[model samples]
Target: MDKNEKSKPSYNQDIIKIIQARYGYSQDYIRKSIRGDRTGIICIMIKDEYIRLNNEALKVIESQLYKL
Candidate 1:
């Protein structure tokens, strides 16, 4: 089987872990937030923004927002 077909059942778990790691959220919280999530848009947004952020500026911004 191809990769997508072989991993279909584990996709949700994989997504959950990725979100949790990135946001420092618990697995349960991520699961609930994404229960009806559409097309992984939230995850994609987060990832895209993450890539665009500079390490130093991101730290400053996060600090200002009390994110760190």
Candidate 2:
């Protein structure tokens, strides 16, 4: 993705609201490396390099946003 595209939001509260309202809840689960904690929510901190490196993953995210 380009710089402008990368500037867009991915995992945030607004998206979370839309997700819950539309899909009800996430079926996918993620296990965090930290202390063996698991969460249905996908967390992303702004300005994180991983967000830029794995931007292709955002396609599904963008598609879901279109449903809102």
Candidate 3:
């Protein structure tokens, strides 16, 4: 990713922690799932959550930029 871009939204962050807790999975597994190393329901759910959170965060950043 470019330096100006945020890091991956699902790694070493509260978002992953929260999801891990809810799904009873390890952080590493979650990361792997997000990185597309794994598959199945959990992977699908995590991918969806990651995308939703990432988009929500971007929208917030965009609105803040517009206000400034």
Candidate 4:
């Protein structure tokens, strides 16, 4: 792996898949969020951007919001 690849933390694929499938978010977005980017999928909900979300996405967003 390259230095950049080695420096980035690895996230759980299962959780990423769950979030992506439920939120319709791209893998890149999910990966960024997992790596501490706050402007990922949660921003869609916060800004009320009219994106459709699955049940799990709603739950995940709620949980994340509480952490803030």
Between candidates 1 and 2, the one scoring higher on lDDT is 1
Cα deviation of 17 in candidate 3 (Å)?
2.6
Indicate the TM-score of model 1: 0.35
Ordered by lDDT, highest first, the candidates read 3, 4, 1, 2
Model 4 error, position 4 (Å): 8.6
Give all TM-scores, in the order shown: 0.35, 0.24, 0.68, 0.46
Residue pairs that clash (backbone atoms under 3 angstroms), model 4: none
lDDT tens readout by residue for model 3, 27-51: 8888888888999997989978977
Whole-model Cα lDDT per candidate? Answer: 0.54, 0.39, 0.80, 0.59
Q: Which stretches of candidate 1 lie over 4 Å from their true place?
A: 1-11, 36-68
Model 3 reaches what TM-score against the true structure? 0.68
3 versus 4: better TM-score goes to:
3
Clashing pairs in 1: none
Model 4 RMSD to the real structure? 9.5
User: What TM-score quantifies how close candidate 2 is to the native fold?
Assistant: 0.24
- The 10-residue segment of model 3 with minimum total lDDT is 5-14
Measured with C-alpha atoms, the lDDT of residue 27 in candidate 1 is 69
Q: Across residues 1-68, which tens digit of lDDT does each residue of candidate 2 receive?
A: 66555453335444444434544444231112111244333332222323443454578779889999
Structure candidate 2, residue pairs in collision: none
